[model samples]
Target: MEYEAIIGLETHIQLNTSSKIFCSCKADSWFDGPNTNICPVCTGMPGVLPVLNKAVVEKGALLAAAMNADLQPVSYFDRKNYFYPDLPKGYQISQYDRPLAKGGWLEVPLDGYQRRVGIWKLHLEEDAGKTKNENGQRMIDFNRCGVPLVEMVTGPDLRSADEAAAYLIRLRQLLRWIGVSEADMEKGHLRCDANVSVRLKGSETFNTKTEIKNVNSIEAVRAAINKEIERQVREYERGGKIEAWTLEWDEDTQTLKKMRSKETEADYRYFREPDLLPVHLTEAWKSAILADLPELPLARKARFIGEYGLPEYDADLLTAERSLSDYFESAVKAYGGDPKRVSNWLLNDVMRMLNESGKIAGELSLTPAYLAEIIKLVDAGTVNTNTGKALLDKVNESGKSPAQLVESEGLAKVSDAGAIRAVVEQVIAESPAEVESYRAGKVGLMGWFVGQVMKKLQGKADAQKARELFEELLK
Candidate 1:
């Protein structure tokens, strides 16, 4: 029987708040050494209390609203009892029965269709510490303890490994676009645990699923999910029952190793936390939080296509980042020309500069206004196309106005008919054989003669006028 894969993701997004969720310790300790950013509250010392960070709540609510989840006016934190080496508190402070939000969906645009991945639940939580095994000894670092995280669980809506990867890519884009998290999978800003199951095609009954962990990248998630699906399919072929297992992805081997059996929700003795009160988001507070939401990635992409007539490919790329999309629109409006022209310059010229300088679109020295000025100069025949393209570099490097660079450097197009005709006459005189070949029906040589004139003029000659001169003088 043909099988279909069902995938759900439990993603832990590290918020970019200034402080940890329940303490004054630093939120991001990625640059710091282990245990350097820790304190008694995060380490769970005896008789210590955690003061909830207000910023965490606001950011979490903003994300929940972006996902279209239903927010709870009053959501309480619970103590998830688990004894792990990395969990110093012996119980993790998380939301259990009553989470902050529930039931939202992300529209992931795949190759040819869109997949709506539903959000099962979203809750605020404090992260556990890190553990590593080395030289037959286990080492623990508490620096990550108490770090603010929004645990978002997605419904089992993905049908294939590609869909799971696409959902993750879209989620990462949304997170950064909304300024919630860096969402860098390699740096652990966004982490995912995929629960994967497969069933016979046309069957609605869900089979036993396996949880795969330690996939640090989207490509790894895709590979691990595909591997697990194949394993379950093989089991079905053998007429054996599949067991729910927790597997770890070995990056070096690109394989999954059985870690243990999957744990049910009952395994963790979850209870309401005694230290903190329930989160009560008043109408005004919710409004204030939602007010911070900007036009999301997909929405802006659609607008780019509809409002500006950008092709879907161009729109998708331009909206990959919020700042870049803002830059594109700003440039378009400033140029006052066809939007596609600005799109091409941005995608090709501006993007190359950004990549080389390790800067984003907004950080460019060549501002949108300056880019528009250059394009206008090109449009009005003040500068040749090559000169206009070179002005991008000159303006960026010198941080001067494009018009100023054109004036100071004598870069304006040689559109004067007398000047171009003189150069074209000189080029034809210097190349008699080529000129004869051109008159004898080697019409392609016309471009070469124009090239020689442009070369002599230092690329300042009006190409169209030179082409006209070549046609007239050659005949």
Candidate 2:
């Protein structure tokens, strides 16, 4: 029987709020030493009361709205009972039965097709602490215990490891662009747990899934799913029932090892937290937040086509990153509506420099004003496109005025007809054989004479003028 892999992901993102979810401790302690940034409330000290951070809830709702999820009128926190050294209180305050948002979808673009991934729910939760393996001892830090986190659960809509990886990447991009989360997998700001199962083709039901926890990066997520799928396939071939289990990814071995059996929902014994009251959001508040949403990547892609008259491919490329699109627009505004030239410069010159330097385009200090100034020099015939590119690279590095660079570097194009005439005359005198060949209809030799003039002038002579002057002297 042909088997198909079904995958779903639970992504945990730490919000960028300044304070802990239920305390006043700083939330910027992610990289600090263990137990240093903790306070009485976050560390779960005896007889301390929890106070909710209003900003965390607001940010969570805003994120849910961005995903087009259905926001609940009211939601609150609950206690998730568990025993782990990483968790200080042994009971986490999270949303259980009623999440902040539910039943949404995100559209992921694949090779020549778009796949819709269903979002099961999004819930606000407090983060647990970190465990460190220092030499031979395990150390616990309570600094991150009360940090705000939003866990997004997706439906079993992914059919392959590629699809799952693509979904995670797109989701991370969205979260980062919104300024809600850094979504850095290496830093553990964003973490993913994938539940994967295999089923017969065309079957309505799925087999028991093994939930793989904390597959940090996209590559790890794909590898874990693939290894688990192969393991289950082999078990089926041996006439064994695939059991529901929990596995951890072993990066060195590049395989999934059994951690323990998977726990059901009832195992946590979730109950509503008595300390925190149910939070409510009004419709007017929701509408105001909706209006504050910026143009997302998909919408900006369409706008680039319709408003700027750019090609679909260029539009897609520009809108892939928000900062890049912003930079392109600023350049267009500075250029006064010349979309095509701006697009070429952005797609070719700016991108080439960025790629070569291994830096983001927005990180450069070359503003729209600077780009417009350079393009004007090219349009006015003061410099050819090649010289213009060189000037732009200089400005990119030194942040000097275009005019100043032109004067200091003597990069000004030699537009003097008289000077170019003299150089072309010299070239004709030296390369008489090539000039004779050109007159004999060896048209390719024309380029040879023109190259001589350009070389004589140190490439300062305008190429078009050099070609014209060469032909005149050759005749």
Candidate 3:
């Protein structure tokens, strides 16, 4: 019997505010000494009261709005009772029964089609401390404790690993556009947990689902979903009753193993957090926050196609990352709205350099003006295409004008018809046999003579001029 996979993702994103959620301890937990960013309140010391960070509240609300969540006027935090060494308070301050936002939908691109994945809720919560082990003994770092986080729970609308990845990509883009979080998986600022189960075709009820926790990377998330689905299918294939289980993804083995039974809603024993009050959002405040939201990926993609006349595929690739899209637009404007050329350089050359250096477009030193100038030179025929490419590489290292780089590197194309004629004649004289083949209807060999002329001229000749001159001489 065919099986249908049911998947839901619970993504935990650390808010980018400077301080912890309920205390003034710096949320700049990265690159700091262990436990250095902690305060008494964050560590849950006796007699300390938790004060909510207003910035965290605002950012959380913005994220909820960006995800198209239905905002509730009044929301409160709850104490999630649980026991863990990392959770020093023996309970986590979270939301239940009443969360800030709910019933939102994020549009995901799957199988070349757009589908809306339902967001169950986006709730504010405090993060737990990190557990570290040296040799064998476990130690707790309270620095991450009480940090602000938004737990975005999605409905079981995702059907496959590909769809899950698409949803995650879109969600990350939304978070970045709203400026709520850095959403860097490598830094653990954003984490995802998935609930996956398999049901028989046309089955009305869901089988026992397993929760795979703390998948940090997108690739890992896809792998976890696929692995869990396979496990569930195997159990049913063997006529074994599906059972609820919690699992952890082992990065080394690339597998999921059972940890425990799935926790029920009542297991956490959620109650209103006594130290905090219900969050109130004013109409004016929402309006002000809404004004600052940047253009999201989908909107930007449409503008790229409508305003710049870029192809849909190129527009999507250009806007896939924020910095890349920004770089592309700036270059287009700088180069007088030449969309196709900008797209070509960005997708081919710029992306190549970024991938090789392991950096984003924003991290590069090259300016849009410099990139535009280089492209302009290529388009104008002042420098040959290869020379323009070489000049682009030197732009980052030397910070010189494109013209200066061309002159200094002797890369200006030999476009003077007289100068190119000499090289073309030399190539035609040396490659008589190849030229004869071209004259005898082997027209593709024209490219071989073009290459020889370019080589003899040290790649300084305009390739198009060389090709034209070769054809003229051969005729």
Candidate 4:
């Protein structure tokens, strides 16, 4: 019997706030020295009290609104008891029964169709510190302690690894578009833990699931989940029981290793926090947050298709990132050319350049105005497409305008009929044997003649004009 995998994700997005959740320490912990950003409240010192940062709650509300989540009017913090070297406090302050938001769904594109993934809850919490194990000793850094995070739990609605990865890509794009978090997996700004289980096809009950942790990248997430699914299927085939356990992904070996037994919710012993009061988000506050949300990814994609007449594939690529979509719009508005033409340039040449340079679209030296000008040059036959593409590198190096570089480098298209006629006559006079073969019905030599004329013209002649001149002179 075939088995199907059930998958869910717990994605933790670090909120981009100025201060920690319950303290005033700086939230930028990426480059700070070890234990430099900690304070009495964050370090959990004696006789210290915790205070909630209003900005953290506001950012959470903004994300909740963007996700179409039901924001609870009243939510309280609870103490989640656990012991770890990285956790400065013996218990972490989190939301349990009354989370900040619930019952929302995100639509992810899968296999050329849309699938709705249910969001079980999104709650606010504090981040733990980092624990690094060197040669023999373990060092703890409290710099990330007390950092604000919103843990989004998803329902087990995914059946395949591809679906899971697609869901994460959409989720990260939404988070970045809404301006809540960077959601960069490399920097630890966003982290994920995937829970996977497999059962016989069409089974109503779920088999024992294993939680895979420390999957730092999206590709690793898909790989780890698939490996677990295979392992579970083999165990069940051998008539062995699948036990609940926690596992870690070894990226170097491309395998999963058992970490420990999975802990249940009861093991955490959650209770209401005695230090802080329950949060109450007024109706006016929710309305204001909902009003401030920008257009999300899916909505923008639909609009690109409808307004710009772009194909679904082009629209999807353009709307993948907020900055990239903005860049495309700016170029379209500036150039006033065919939107499809601009889309082609961006999706092909511009994206390739960005990837090769290891820079983002926003960070590249090529601005929207410059790209628009280049597209205009190509459309007007002032420069051929090859010269236009090569001009981008020149523009990046010399910081010159497209028109200026074209003139200085003699890269402009040579549309002068007289000038191209001279080169075509020279090619015919130089190659008597080839010319005789062409006259003797070697029709394929027409392309060879055009190529010779273009080489003589230094790639500055319009290819179509050169071809016409070749055909005329040969006859």
TM-score, one value per model = 0.96, 0.90, 0.90, 0.91
Kindly report which residue stretches of model 2 are placed more than 4 angstroms away from their true locations once superposed. 263-266, 355-360, 398-410, 425-459, 471-475
RMSD of 2: 2.9
Which has the greatest lDDT? Answer: 1
Candidate 2's displacement at residue 20, Å, is 1.8
Better of 1 and 4 by TM-score: 1
Per-model CA lDDT versus the true structure:
0.93, 0.85, 0.86, 0.90
Candidate 2 lDDT, tens digit per residue, 454-473? 78877777988888877666
Clashing pairs in 4: none
Candidate achieving higher lDDT, 2 or 4: 4
Off by over 4 Å in 4: 395-411, 430-448
**On lDDT, who's better, 1 or 4?**
1
Cα shift from native, residue 397, model 2 (Å): 3.7
lDDT of candidate 3 over 4-51, digit per residue (tens): 899999989999999989999999679898889988798888889999
Clashes in predicted model 1 = 0
RMSD of 3: 2.7
Q: Candidate 2's error at 442, in angstroms?
A: 9.3
- Cα distance off (Å), candidate 1, residue 339: 1.7
Cα lDDT tens digits, model 4, 291-395, are 878889999999999999999999999998988999999999999978999899899999988889887778767888889999899988999887888887788
What does candidate 1's lDDT look like per residue over 280-354, in tens digits?
999999999999999999999999999999999999999998888999999999998899999999999999999
